[model samples]
Target: MKKILLACSAGMSTSLLVAKMKEAAEKRGTEVEIWAVAQDKAPSEMKKADVLLIGPQMRFMKKKFAVVAEEVGIPLDVIDPVAYGRIDGEAVLNKAIELIGE
Candidate 1:
């Protein structure tokens, strides 16, 4: 199973998106593990994830997030604002696959 870690300012906003992504994965028969957490807690969460996706508000921290992900050989990226706000699960899942070379 693939693991995706979502990070936001306080982990509140992305929590909703997490549910949508999960449903999308389920409906599409994609075996993925998704979770949302505050940006500050990302380091601990990263250990368990195969990829790290950040929300629009947290895009500025992409460099920092990338650094951590690289250290552990995990891919990292910022989610598309359009897909994120609209909760476009298919697009988000596609993006994750692209980022991770799936």
Candidate 2:
């Protein structure tokens, strides 16, 4: 199974996106686990994920996250603001798969 993680400011904001992403995975018959975490907890959560996506609002920390992600061999990206604002789970899911070369 592929493990995908999403991080936002307080974690709560991404809850809806997480649900949508899960549904998209189910429909596609993809073996994936998706979860959202607060930015502060991201580093610890990274070890368990195959890919990590940060909310657009947290884009500033991408540089910092990129360094940590590189050390652990996981791809990281800032979610598109337009998709995020509209809660485009499929787009995010596709992005995650692309990032991990799925």
lDDT of 1 by residue, 1-102 (tens): 888899999998988788888888899898998899999999889989888999999899999888889888898889999999898877888888777787
**Candidate 2 worst ten-residue window by lDDT:** 63-72
lDDT of 2 by residue, 2-98 (tens): 9999999999999999999999999989989999999999988998999999999999999989988998999999999999999999999999999
Deviation of model 2 at 78, angstroms: 0.3
Off by over 4 Å in 1: none
Which residue pairs clash within candidate 1? none
Clashes of 2: 0
What's the alpha carbon RMSD for model 1?
1.0
| TM-score of structure candidate 1 | 0.94
User: What lDDT score belongs to each candidate, Candidate 1 first?
Assistant: 0.88, 0.95
